[model samples]
Target: MKRHTAREKAFQLLFQMDLNEFDPNEELHEHHGEEEIDSFLETLVQGVVQQQTTIDENISYHLENWSIRRIASVEKTILRIATYEILYMEDIPTNVSINEAVELASKYGDEKSGKFVNGVLSKIIA
Candidate 1:
């Protein structure tokens, strides 16, 4: 899978996991059906899950006035995904992560989500 497609799928899987309390394995199976899971997709989902606490902490610190819990689920999920890539995936450029996250936000979240994601990620990257 292309990185873009993998990232989007990872966001969907993680979003379901966060909102519906679905198990990762179940979501993965459900999402891919009989197809082999993309390695990057699996990596993104697992990496976000494994490093969630630290990622949340990083986001919380970078947030201006809003608490991490106060952010909408979509925005929070996008933030976590981008933050995970920024912090852990040395091969992907930080700007690429941030830009992709903003795209995800614009597609799946409210109109303000893109800017909100970009702002928080900018702070995190700094």
Candidate 2:
């Protein structure tokens, strides 16, 4: 059987986070084992979880009055993952990270989520 890629796993893990609203590490354990996730994705997930406050702070900084919580859970998750990738995962290009996050937001968020994600990430990139 085909397994979920790191990115796919990250999406689901992030989704679980929205529902659970707990520590990402615990949420990760409930949803995926070490073998179920890849090294890169695991690193990304852990990094995001660890630096969430800072990452979110940066996002919130760029959001003006829009808090991260006010944003849709899917959009928040995509942003968290993408922000982690762009800020920490130096191996990945900034555009690739933002584009992937925007794509995920488009699929999992509301109709305008793509634009929202793009706008926020573009601000970070700028």
Candidate 3:
């Protein structure tokens, strides 16, 4: 089985929350056919949700003239995923995290969202 992209999975969970007020933790079982999620991605998703305040802080610190609350839902989700990967998963290269984040933003976020994710992550990595 192909593993679902973390952002893609997160997108579904977040969308469900937005529309139905369901808990994200409980909603994850509704997996669509996709790549098998590795342990790393599972950790990333959980870490992001568990340490959202720290992730939001990292984003706020790196994002000039932007607040975490003001970011779009898609962009925010990508940021949280990538930030968690960056901070918690040492095995995944920094470049891969940044690239995945950019891809996620492009697919789910607005036109400007990819650039924003890239910029903030670059700062965090540097």
Lowest summed lDDT window (length 10), candidate 3: 24-33
**What tens digits encode model 2's per-residue C-alpha lDDT throughout 1-126?**
121257767778867776877776676666665545456767867887789899999889888679888987788878888888888878889998887887777777889999999999999989
Q: Best lDDT goes to which candidate?
A: 1
What TM-score goes with each of the models? 0.96, 0.84, 0.80
Residue 34, candidate 1: Cα error in Å is: 2.3
TM-score: model 2 vs. ground truth? 0.84
Give per-residue CA lDDT, model 3, range 34-61, as digits (tens). 5445454456556776787888888889
Which stretches of model 3 miss by more than 4 angstroms?
1-4, 14-21, 32-38
| Each prediction's RMSD to truth | 0.9, 2.8, 3.1
Error of 1 at 88 (Å): 0.3
C-alpha displacement of 19 in model 2, angstroms? 2.4
Query: Clashing residue pairs, candidate 2?
Result: none
**Model 2, which residues run further than 4 Å from truth?**
1-4, 21-36
